[model samples]
Target: MLLELKILFARQAEQQLLQTTRDFHSCKQEEGQLVSSYVLKMKGYIDNLERLGHPVTLGLVLGKIINELHAMLKLYEQTLPKNNAPALHVIRAVKVKKLNKHKKSQPQMAAMGQNHGKGKNREVYAPKPKIPPPPKREDPAKDSICHECGETEH
Candidate 1:
């Protein structure tokens, strides 16, 4: 459960990092500097998380990092300039947006086996073909008998 939450958080962070990279690249030189720096910090965290094979530890670290960043964002809000963004503010905004998106994307229960274990060959579960209900029982009056032999089917 904790692991599921953590993986979701990490994925959201990854998406935000990508978004920040795009936004930073779009900004003017001075403005872009902060975005780039923020992107680097986030990329480091993301890369570490990606290399993990399990979710529990990665999720805990990411959750802690996320909370710390939230705190830092509030504490450093004023660090941003009126016309230019500060590195903290850019990263904080990206983190907030990414976490929100992460919440929305993840299912309530952790996916059964989204991560770990070498995948195996398996048969698909297509439903069996339907067979029509057995034909209605024959009635002597409604069913015809064989003309000569009088066999039931005939």
Candidate 2:
């Protein structure tokens, strides 16, 4: 009876280990997924696999993380540590620092890079035309030409 129980327990443990391994291998970061959350989920699987007597190495976890990370996190791919928590912290720190720096200068950089000639900076009004006033109408009786001669009367 004791031997049978040990065998059954061992088989159940083996099956659990296999399932955990599958979960770890199949885990991947979704589009726009948070890196911290993804890393934490993987770590949870690793912990479970460890509990089932399956060893999960730091390097293996790191490789899985690198494979599953989004393209935006690629910059830190070569530099991240092999361990889990520290790697998550460093990635978050780098991303936050980069975002803050970018936010401060993004508008100015955009304005400098784009052509504003026909954009929002374009002039809205054209110059007005200069026109002369009409001359005052002359009084015919007060300042008129003489009928007999081609001369003006005082």
Our tally of clashes for model 1 stands at 0
Predicted candidate 2 versus true structure: per-residue lDDT over 1-154, tens digit per residue: 9999999999998888888888888787777678798889999999998888776889988877876664445645656665534546556666666665565444674678774446534333322556999887588666777788868864
Which candidate's lDDT is highest?
2
The lDDT per prediction is 0.54, 0.72
Clashing pairs in 1: none
lDDT of 1 by residue, 1-154 (tens): 9999999998987776666545433422233346456546655555544544323356654564566456555655666564465445456556765665555443433376553333322222323558899777668644767778886554
Q: If candidate 2 were superposed on the true structure by all CA atoms, what would the RMSD be? A: 19.4
Candidate 1 C-alpha error for residue 133, in Å: 88
lDDT value, candidate 1, whole model: 0.54
Q: What TM-score would every model get versus the actual structure?
A: 0.20, 0.44
Return the lDDT, model 2, position 1.
100
Off by over 4 Å in 2: 70-154
